[model samples]
Target: MDERELRNCFGKFPTGVTIVSWFDGSVQKGITVNSFTSVSLDPPLALVSIHKEAKACTGMKDKAFTINILSDEQESIAWQFAGSKQEILEIDWDNKGISPKINGSVAWMECKPWREYDAGDHVLFVGEIQELHFEDLEALTFYQGKMGSAKQLVK
Candidate 1:
């Protein structure tokens, strides 16, 4: 299959949205990411995939990162980060201490790099969870190129 076909196939799988953040001097840089997952519960490890050509890819390679899991109310926050200009809104980042994170996200996982693997067009970054925080809220999800809500799973 071609690139478009491959991307479409991948899109079939819905995933949660996250903001992968890292510090660049006094500025904290991050981007919206959906290619993130838990790798091991025993070690509290997670992974995020970034495009090889993306600017954030290199920054993540050398520094610690944070995965801010968005809440359903954070759709605007997600859109801002994912937008072409990377326009972020005025958010309450005081809770983050040093790094920046969206206010009222469902959870935040602060991590340090464990390893990096080179995939075809993306680099898979494995991270060891150093810190984690959670709030009482529903998570946001993405499916087939659109934001979606999760319904109850009836047994």
Candidate 2:
């Protein structure tokens, strides 16, 4: 039972990078998340897994939030929210939606908390997508512990 090896194995799979943004009463907060996924089409549900200690998840329970799908050019923005970089993010915001949308993102979804569950060291926040915005841009990705540049694959 090698946890490090297991994490490496999980990292081998490519995943899209996203920023989960929420307001914590006093200020806006965001965190870079790679565990976001679509759960259902009929109900328009999505999920984002956040570590129990994430600063962004401080006051997110039962609240509205935004999931910003980052473009490859937004790697720096991701790093900023990830707390892996020192530079503060100076991004634009769209206040038209139920939540604040990150401007210049490849896509975004305003969501409301639908459900939550415990998952070992993380909590899974299932959100019901209320509205969305998107563009045809390459998405930022991660694989094998490295940031990846992935272009949109047309179907």
What are the per-residue Cα lDDT tens digits for candidate 1 across 102-150? 6688999888888999999899999888888999888888876777455
- The digit string of per-residue lDDT tens for model 2 on 19-104 reads 99876664667889999999999999999999998765656877899999999989888888888775665778776656778889
| CA RMSD of each candidate after superposition | 3.0, 2.9
lDDT of every predicted structure (CA atoms): 0.80, 0.85
Task: Please give the lDDT score at residue 31 for candidate 1.
Answer: 82
RMSD (CA, Å), candidate 2 to true, equals 2.9
For model 1, what is the alpha-carbon lDDT of residue 146? 76
Off by over 4 Å in 2: 151-155
Error of 2 at 113 (Å): 0.7
Can you give the lDDT of residue 19 in candidate 1? Answer: 87
lDDT for 57 in candidate 1 is 86
